[model samples]
Target: MVFEKDPTSLYQIYPTTVAVIGARYGDELNFMAAAWHTLLSFNPPIFGVSISPKRYTHDLLMKSGEFTASFLGHGHAELVEKLGRTSGSKINKVLEYGLELLEPRVVKVPGIGNAVAVYECRVLESRSYGDHTFFVGRIVGLHYDPRAFDEVGRPAYDPVLYLGKDVYVKIDRSRTIEFDPEKFRK
Candidate 1:
């Protein structure tokens, strides 16, 4: 039997890779792990990250007009959790976590050096939706660890997937399969 409940319990989309959103404005820098991010477009390479106004990274992103989204492997789940739980206003997450910063080729903001992939983006627009502000950015530069992906661009490394409520998981590659969509078309 199917069960339904209030919309507030809508965290069904759990196994999503966490993207570490990094922002820098002048001398200030901060990083936050966000599961609420996605690739919005392919033509212009637009990406969106949702952040609450209360977050310090949100303020830096507004001032800088640029940011970096870094996707790390499953091995960094602990680091991701730490970054997401702590407030950047009260602590220097990068310095406290001992994360290495990587220089961006097109934006002022840097990315986590150990990231599997990083996208340097310039803010295209920002809109408030409920409690969070959705920032859309046009990707200007991309960095990736070639070994972490297959030739066709499929992830070869185990990505850190958030299971909500401070839980994390990784893909079981042993169960992975490749299929042709046309085979299912009747």
Candidate 2:
């Protein structure tokens, strides 16, 4: 195997869940599919979504100070792709796609009705990192489909995983393995 110092094409982490970031400012609402998002902290329940400055959602996020990270199942891959490719600035994606939005509990932004899990967050901070701005948010509310998650919070349903370059995949639960670190104790 060979490796390069430049990390331009290093998208090794391909199977990450696609996070549909929803933001609203007044009557304007937008949802963008983001492959670059993760849980920042557990103590204060913080989440972060890396969005480019040119995205319409970025402007709404800054003005609203709140957003929702909605995780959809594998069945919605087509919808996710549509959301990622289109720009909210040019058209109303929600109306065009006929997306059903759920009423938010804590934040002003609503989540996709079909989402398996949605995290309603209030903006904590935003900082520039390269071409994207990392928006850190404190989780204010959580909505999850109980049927989609196991008792220990493991995903029971196939989740939409982005593989970059317009590709998508899902988990095969039949191949899942449970590993215990205690067995490897020195």
Candidate 3:
């Protein structure tokens, strides 16, 4: 198997906005928006989210060792940017944005209700990689709006996707296509 240099440009990957909710170390609570989140496993339900040490939310997650991943819903593009740009050490991002919070059953950190889905997670492991730390969490509790669930029980909420440098997108679920490696690689 061969691969080219790191060509995973911003245009190459579909983006999703995630609200990282956790308790601050000393006091207070914090929830920051993140774009670097992905599912790592399904059996134990684990997710991988990368956070920079400079981010105030990072310190909180590190201290509590638990957090929530809340998916952003429509009309939330501006809120995501606002939370990502501001520092919780100086300002209360949740209160500033008028975001509603819900107490999770397993964690002290609250989950954002604005999102279609919220995964209440406990940190299973953390590893520092380069300029950021990646946290692997196991999902302990999950919540979502029933209206956002489709007839098939899948989430129907259209997630707001982040494009590098400041662009937002929503999933075009109607445009899915089946792929065949042999047909396209030749």
Candidate 4:
């Protein structure tokens, strides 16, 4: 077909799993919808989220040195977009939405009680890259809703994957395949 040359912020690597980051400074709690995040390390369970320094959640993150990553489901897309559209400094979004929160097991911050998966992390390192800052946190605690996994403990892939620009899709577990890794070995 045809080819085009463009080097813009085209978010080509989207359809990414969405998560709502939760942070608390003392008694004040905040949450933000994030599509850019990843598991930085498996051994230490380090997780990282890129945040613009201007965001109110970024301030809470630095002040508390702790945060929670809550995996969102398809049902939460509207709530996710609402949080992304406004600044937490303007209103208490948690109370505004009547979002349920969980008592964190290891950190002072809170986790979304209705989350399919949750990770409570304590900051290990933070570095700036352009307008955004990457904060690496060591996972201190983790949990997943029992219903999200199969009997053998394989996770049912039903996460809300953000396609960018306010679009999202939930992965279907029925399309799953249990591949044999050794069969493809070189």
Write one digit per residue (lDDT tens) for candidate 3, span 52-164. Answer: 89988888888889888887775788877787778898988767878788778887778876778889888999999977899999999998888988886766776667865
Model 2: per-residue Cα lDDT over 29-94, one tens digit each: 999999999999998899998999999999999898999999999999999999999999999999
Q: What overall lDDT, based on C-alpha atoms, would model 2 receive against the true structure?
A: 0.93
What does candidate 1's lDDT look like per residue over 84-186, in tens digits? 9998899999889999989899999999999999999999999999889999999999999999999999998999999988999878878978899999989
Candidates in order, TM-scores: namely 0.94, 0.94, 0.82, 0.90
Model 2 stretches with alpha carbons more than 4 Å out = 1-8
lDDT of each: 0.93, 0.93, 0.78, 0.87
State the lDDT of candidate 4 residue by residue for 52-160, as single tens digits.
9998999999898999999867888888888788889999988999989988999988888889889999999889997789999999999888988789876665677
lDDT of 4: 0.87
Which window of ten consecutive residues has the lowest lDDT sum in model 1? 1-10
Pitting candidate 3 against candidate 4, the one with the higher TM-score is 4
Model 1, CA-based lDDT: 0.93
- Backbone clash pairs for candidate 1 read none
